[model samples]
Target: MNRFRFRIRFEDRVGMVRDVAEVVSGHGANILSLEVKPGEMHIQVDQVSPTVLENMLKRVQTIANVLEVTPVEWLPHELAQQRLRAILDTVEEGILVVDARGTVSLCNRKAAEILGLGHSLIGNSLKHLGFPREILTSLGVGRLSQQEILLSTPYGRLRCLVKSQPLVDEEGKPAGAMITFEKMSQVRRLVQSLTQPVMITFEEIIYASQKMAEVVALAKTVAKSDSTILIRGESGTGKELFARAIHMASPRRDNPFVVVNCAAIPDTLLESELFGYANGTFTGALKGGRQGLFEFAHQGTIFLDEIAEIPPYVQAKLLRVLQEGCVRRLGEMLENKVDVRVIAATNRNLEEMVAEGSFREDLFYRLNVIPLYLPPLRERKEDIPALAWHFIQKFNQRLGKNVRSLSEAALRRLYDYDWPGNVRELENVIERAMNLAQGERIEPENIILPEKNLASKSPSGLKRAMEEIERQAVIEALNQGGSVRKAAKILGVSHTTIINKMRRYRISGKTSGQWK
Candidate 1:
C-alpha cells in the first residue's frame, strides 16, 4: 500500500484540521493517523499514487492558514513506536501488549525468547497460546490482575507471575492490555539470595535418634505455618540453628531472616533495639531514626534467641508487637504495622521467670504458642557417633587436617561422658581432637573433655541410661555365657534380639570374661 506522511505548518485555528481532512478525502485516500500541535500538524494517509500525492499536497497548500507542507517517510507516532520497542527490549522481563480484540500487537524480543517463539508474535491471538479466552477478554477490556500461574509454552512449562495493565484512550475506554511475564525462578533467586541465606535445613541438624527425629519432623510440620514458634532447649542445644532451619523451610524464606540475641544486648538498649527510637530520641541516634529488628523482619521471620533474657520493659513492648501485629518506636507513639513471623528461642526456663515475676505472664503465653524442644546431646548419645564424624570432616577442611574418623574407644569415651555444654561442647572437643590427632583417626588419647564435664555418672536421660544398662548387661552375660545363645537366656530375650541389641550398641567379644 502506498502510505504518505506530511508535516503541515498551519496557523493556530479551529477549522484548520477540517480543511486538511476534506482535501485528503477528496483524493480518494484514507487518513491513517493525525497529530496536531500549536503551529504544526503531522498526518499519514494510504492508497495514494505519487502523482496523486503531489496534486493533493498542492491543493492542501492552497488552503487558508496552511503555510508550508513537507512530505516525510516517518510520522511522529512511528518514531515513538520505534523508541518504545527499543525501551521494551531493554527490559529484563518479557513484555507483551495485546489490543482490545486479544490480538498481540507488540511483543518484545525477551517475550519471544521466553515463549520459545519466532520474532513474529504480532497479529497472533493470545488465546492461541493456551490462555483462557474469557480471561484474555477480560484483561483485553481492562479488568486487570496480577497472578502467579503456570503457563505452558513451546519451550517448556513455566511458573511465572503475570501482571497486566489496561491501555486506555483519552476518555478512559479500553484500547488494549499491556501484560508482562516474569519467570518466578528469577524472582525467587532475587528474593532469596544464594550465598547470603543462613543455609540451615532440617537435614543439616545431624541427628539419628528417634527423639531428635520426632523433633525434626515436628519442626518441619510447623515450618509451613506463620504462627509464633518457641524453641525450648538448654545452652548449646542448637536453638538458633533450629530457628534458622524453620525460617528457611517456611514460605517466608525468600524474605528477610532477622536474628536478635536478647541476652547478648544490654537491658538498657534492649527496648531501643527491638523497637527503633525516633530521631534525636537519644544523644547518638540515627539521622532519620533507624528501623528496629521487627520492622526489618517485615514479611519474613525474626528469630529472638535467648528470649527469656529480655528485660521486663522490653517484654511488654514485644508483647505489644506480637499481640497487635505492630510496633512503636521508643520515642514515637505511632504504631507501625509489620507482617513478620516471630520464632523465639530460649535456653532458660521462662515459666520459672514468670513465677518469679521477672517476666510478663502475657508475653510468656504469647511466645509459647508452638513450643519445639531440642534434646541435649548427652540425652541422645546415638547421635554422638554421627555428630563426631560430622565435626571431624568439618574441622578437617578448616584446620587442613585429614582426620578420617574417631576411634571406637574415643567414641566410647564421648558416649560415656555427660555433656553439660551439649552439641556446642561436642564440636569444640572434636576440633581439639582434630588438632591433636597424629594418625588418620582420632584416638581416645587425642579426645579431651572439660574435667568438670566428665563425671563418674553416665550420659543423662532414661533412654541412654537404659541403653547403658542393657549394654553392660549384654557384656556381663556374654562374659558369663561365652555365647550369644546363653547370653539371650541370661537377658530373658530371644538370641536374635540379643544379637541385634549388641550390634546396635556396638558390643562384641569372642572369648569369655573378655567382653569389650
Candidate 2:
C-alpha cells in the first residue's frame, strides 16, 4: 500500500500532461493529488503498486521526459486490493488471479469470454478451464511464466495467450500467481488479409514501351478504385492483358479473376454461359443447375474479352447485370444478388458500332467508367528493337538454339518495315527468323519481306535484255566466291560498290555459278 510521487515533463509543456494522465489511467492508477509546475507536474497516488508505477513511468518517459519517481505509503492492503480490482474490472482486457495452488482466486467477465467460460471460474482449478495441468503446476512452482494456448469451446476454437506472474511474500518466496489472456484468432485473420496473393498484377504483364508504361500506370490507378474499366485496342495489342492487370491490382485481387471470350463463343451459348440457367432450363442443364461466371465470380472480378462481339440480346442481359448488380437464370423468376467487378476489352470500335446503331449506348457508358486506350505497334516503333530482342530470347529458349542475338543490319530492316499486326506480328517474324537461322546471329536472309511491285527499268529495249544478262553473270560470279569481299575482288570492283550492286540485283544463290 504505497503511494508514488512522480514528476513528469513534456516537451513544450503542450500535451505531455494529458498523455501522462492517460498512461497512468490505462494502467489502473488513481491520481490522488496533482499540481502543475512550470514545465512539469508533481503527481501523488495511493494504491499503485511498483509494477503499475513502472509501466506508467515507462510510457510517460517515451513521450518527452520524466523527472523523478518516489514512493509514499498511503492505503493499506484491503482497501488497495478493492480499488485495484474495481479499476481492472473496467478494462477491456481479460483479467484473472490464480493462487499458488493453481486455483482461480478471481475472474472478470472479459476473462471468462476470452477463455470460453464464465467468471464462475473463481474457486475452480484453472486446469479445468483448459490451462494444461503441467503448465499450471509449473506456474505455481515459478518455473513457467507465460505461454500461448488454443482453447476449444461450444462457440468455436479460440486462440488464447496467457501471461503469468508469481506473487512473492515478504520472505521473497513464491506464494500466488496471476494470468492474463486475450483472444488470438482476430489477429491471425488480419495478418492473412494483409499477406494474401494477388491473382493478376501489373508486373505480370511485360512491356518496355512508353505507351505501355503509360497504360499500366493508368490501370494501376484505376484498379485501386471501384470503377468499371473498358480496354480498347487492336486484337493483338494486349487489351486483355491490360484488363487482367487492372483486376489484379484492385482490392478484389484476392478473389477470383474469371475470363470470358465473347468472340470465341456463339451468341446462342454466350447468354446461358454468362448468366447461369435454372434447373431444367435447357437440354444439357446440370442436375441442380449451374452458377454463371458472374455468380461464381461474386465478390471478385470478371474479364470480358472481345466484349464488342457480344450479341444484342446478350448485351441487354449484360447491361442488366452491370446496372442491377443481380442475375436471373434463363427460366428463373427470382434474381440473385451478386458483387462482381467488370473489366471489358475489345479490338472493335464500340463508338462506331454505337454510331451504326449496332451496340447499346447505355451499356457502353456503363462499362466505360474508365477507358484505357492502347497504341498499335507501328505507332510505337521505338519499342520494336526491345520487343524484337525479347522475342528472340523467348524463341531461342523454345528452339534450344545457340541464337545469341539479331544482327544490327537485320534489326534495322525489321524496324523499317510496318508491322500491320503489332506485337503479334513482330513475334511471328522473330519466330520465323529463328527457324531459318543456322548460327547464333540472325542474318537479313533469315527475314522474308513482302514483294513490292514496280514498272520494269527498261520497258521496250534490246539493251534491257543485255543488261539483265550482265547482271546474271555478276551474281553468278559472287555466288562462286560466297563471300562479298571475295566476290568484289573476283568481279574487279571495290567491295562496297560491289555489295551495293549485288543488293540491287537481289542476288542470292539459286543458279549458284551460272550465267545465261
Candidate 3:
C-alpha cells in the first residue's frame, strides 16, 4: 500500500476542505489523515498507487491560491485510479467532463442549469459560449483544474463553483480532465420582494385639496426621472414624507434610502459621513475602510434635507460627485463609483441665497432640475378638514383615545384661523384639542386658534398685498384698452396691452358698471 500526502492553499475560507476532500476521495486514495493550517494545509492519503500519484498532484495544484504540491506515496496504482474517477463522478455538484482537447464530455444536471443549456452540452466547446476564455483554455492544456468562473447564458449571469481534476494515462501523465460545478445560491425571493416592493401612488399621498393634488402630481413627474429635485416648503409640510414617497416611486427604490439632515449634523462630521475614509485614514478610522453614505447608498436614493444649510465647501464636493458620478473618500485616492438619486428639501429660499452669494448658482441649477413647491396650509385651506380628520385618527390610534371627529363650530374655527406653521401646526392643535375634549367630538374650546391679532396680521397683510397688486394691474389694463392708442399712449404701454387689459379686468370704460 502506497500513501500520498498533498498540501494545498485556498484563496477564501468557505468550504475549501470539504471540496478538497471530495476531490481526494474521488481519486480512490483512502485518507490516512488530513491537517489544516492558516494559508497552508497538508493532506495525507493511504492506498494511492505510485502510477496515479503524479496525476493527483497536478490536479490539486490547479486550485487557485495553491502554493505547492509534494507527492509522498504508499499505495497500489490501479485501485487508486478507479477510486478517484468514481469519487469525481459521484460528486453532488454538477460536473463538466472534458477531454484534453477541451471538448465537453459529460455534465451533471446542475451544470446544465448553470450554463442555461440543456443536458445536451456533451459535444460543445466552452469557448463557443460566454464562459471566460482563460478558464476554458486552461482546462484544455491541463494546467488548471478549479477556477471560479462567470458564465452568461439565456437564463442570466451565473456564478459557478468550479473544481477540476485530470484524467491520467497508464504512464501517469495527464490525459483528460473533469470539472465539477456548484451553482451559487441566490438570496430568497421574499427578501428581494421586501427590499423592493411596489410604489405608493400619488393618490396615496393623503391630501384632498387641489393644491395638494397638484403637489402630488408634480412629485410624480419628479419621481419619473433621475434628476435632482428640490422640494421647498415649511416645516411640518411633510417635506421628508414626500421625499420618501418620491424615492419609493423612483427607479432607485431597490437600493437604500439614506437621509442626511444638513441642519441636524455638525459641519465638521457631515463631510466624512457623506464620504467614508480609508483604514487608518484618520484617528478613529474603522478596520479596512468605512463606506460613506454614497457608497452605502449605491444604486439608491439620498435625501438631503435642509440642503440650504450645507456648507460651501461641502457643496462643492457634492457638486463634483454629482457631475463625475464618483465619490472620493476623505483620506483615500481611490474614487468609488456610485449611482444615487438625490432629493433635496429646504424651508429657505435657495434663489435668494444664490443672489446673496450664500449659495452657488451652478449647484443651485443642478439641484433645481425638478422643483416642487408645497403650498403652505393657508392657501390649501380646502384640505384642512380632511387633513385634520386624518391626524385625529392617527393620534386617536396612538394615544388609545376614541375620539371620532370634530364639532361643526370647531371645524369652522380650524378653517377660519390662519395656520402659521401650516399642516404641522394644524396637527398640533388637533392633538391638543383631542386631549382636552371630554367627549368623542372635539369642540371649539378644545381647539385653540392662533391669537386673533397674530392671525389677522398675516391673513390681512396677504389679502391687502394681493388685492393691491390685482387692483393696480386691472387699472393699467383698462387704461390701455380705452385709447387703444391714447390710453396706451398715456400709460406708456402698447396698444395690444390696452385690449388685453380690458379683457382681463372685465371693464369697458364707457359702461356705467365700469365707471362705478
Candidate 4:
C-alpha cells in the first residue's frame, strides 16, 4: 500500500467532487483526505498498487470539464504542518501548542531541550509535566500573559518565563493555546551582555605595565573562588571596575552584579537601604517593605564601594550577614536568608580604620578574605600613551570629532605629569582636550591639567611637584648605577649630596613603587 496526494483542477459544477471520489473508488483506492475549491481540489489516498494510482490519475482527467489532474508531494493539511515546523524551528524560544483539553498537540526542538525530555511530548497530558489540573480554568482560557514558573524536570528545577496566547476557531470558540518558554539561562546571558559601559570584564581594564598585568592575573585567579573579595586602592583608582570584573569572571557571572556606593548613602538610611526596612518603619517607607541589595543579589554578587565609610551600627549588621548568610529588616524581628557573594572595595586604609575604631575589626577580616590591590595610573605610566589613545577613540564618538592622535609634545607632557585622579581623571582630560581641539590632532596647548582634582596628587603644589621630579631623577640614576657614588656621577652631584637627598625624600627600593 502507498499514500499518494494530488492536486486536481475542475469546473465549478454540482457533483464534481463526487465524480472524482467515484474514480478513486473504482480503482479500489480509499480516499484518506480531501479539500475542494471552486476550480481546484487537493487530496491524499491510500492506494493498493502503483498501477491503480496511475490509472486513477488518468481516469480523473477524463471526466467532463476536468481540465487537468496533477500529483502533489503533500496534502493541504500536511503542507501547512511542514511550513509551520520550519518556522517554529527557526525561533530560539521553546514553543508548544496544547489543545483545550491539555493534551500536547505540538512541541518544537527547543521545547524538548528546555524540558530535558528524551521522548515525544505530543498527546501527553500537561499534568505529566507538573502542570496544575486547574491551570487552564475558565477564567484563564482565552488569555495568559508572561509569568515566571518553575517546572520540575529530570535535569532539575527548570525555571522559565512562560507566555500563552489562546487559539480560536472561525466562530471565535476557545482553542488550544500557544505557549512560549524563555529559558532562565538565556535570560541571564542577556542581562550580562546589556548595559555596555557598566557590564565590564577583565579585558576592559587598560594597562601596559608588568605590575598591572600581575595584578590582573592575580585578580583572575581569585575570581574563580567564592570568597569575599576586598579591593584596596586609592580614590579614583578604579576599585569598582576591578570589583565588576571579578564578578563577571566568577561562577555567578550570569546572575546580578549589584553595586552600592556606601559613602553616597546617608549614615542613617544606609541600614534600611542595605538590609531593607519593614512597612511603616519610617514615614517614606513602602507599604509592603522592600528587598535589600543582599536579597536582590541572591545567587549573585554585590559590590560595596567605600566600605570603610559604613557606620559602626551598619558594620555590625554587615558582619552578621557575612557570618550567617542572612539579613534582618529594620523594625522587623524576622531575618531573611540570602546567598549573595560579597565584593567590598575601599580606598581608605581599612587596617588603620580598624585600629582607630572607625570600622569594625571582625568585619574587615571577613571582607579581606581575598584581597586585591589595584595599582594607580601614575605607577603604570608606561600605559599612558595607550590609555590616552583609547580615550581619544571613545571621545570621538561622543564629541563628534575626528581627533586622530596626540602630538609628541602632548604625549611628553602626559608622561611628565602626575595623574592625580587615576584612570577616570585621564578620561576627563582627554574629553576636555577633544572638546578644545581645533584640528584633528590634540596638541600640548589643548591638554589642560586641572589645578586640583578630588585632591592634589602632590603636596605644597609646585614645591612638592619639583621635589617629586627630583626624586624620580635621583631614583632613575641610582637604579641604573646601583650605588650613591655612581648615581652622583650621573646626577652631576657629589656622593654626599646624593645620600642626603635620598634620606630627605625617603627614597628606597621599597618606596620607589613600580619605578623599581
The Cα local distance difference test for each model comes to: 0.81, 0.73, 0.72, 0.81
Candidate 1 per-residue lDDT, tens place, 35-74, comes to: 9989999999989888988899999999998889998888
Cα deviation at 229, candidate 3, in Å, is: 0.8
Which pairs of residues clash in candidate 4, taking residues 3 or more apart in a chain or in different chains?
A: none
Question: Positional deviation of 181 in candidate 3, in angstroms?
Answer: 20
Comparison by TM-score, 3 against 4, better one: 4
In the predicted model 2, the residue pairs found to clash are 3-72
TM-score of each: 0.58, 0.50, 0.54, 0.63
Which candidate achieves the best TM-score against the true structure?
A: 4
Worst 10-residue stretch by lDDT in candidate 4? Answer: 131-140
Query: In model 4, what lDDT does residue 59 have?
Result: 92
If ranked by TM-score, best first, what sequence of candidates would result?
A: 4, 1, 3, 2
Q: Which ten residues in a row have the lowest lDDT in candidate 3?
A: 184-193
Give residue 218's lDDT in candidate 3 (0 to 100).
Answer: 81
Each model's backbone clash number: 0, 1, 15, 0
Mark the regions of model 1 whose C-alpha exceeds 4 Å error after superposition.
Answer: 1-195, 453-516
- Model 2 Cα lDDT, one tens digit per residue, 1-516: 677776655445566668778888888889887767676567777687778777877777776555544443433444577888788778666777877777888887788777666757788877777776555766556644345454556665454555777777789877777777765433333433665344446786667778778988888888888778898887678776676677777887766667889877766688888987765888977744665778767777888998877767889999999999988878878786778899998877788777665679999999999998999887788888778788888998899987888888898888777666677878888899999999999998897765432212233467668768878767766767777677778878877666446534545444454421
Question: What range of 10 consecutive residues in model 1 has the weakest lDDT sum?
Answer: 507-516
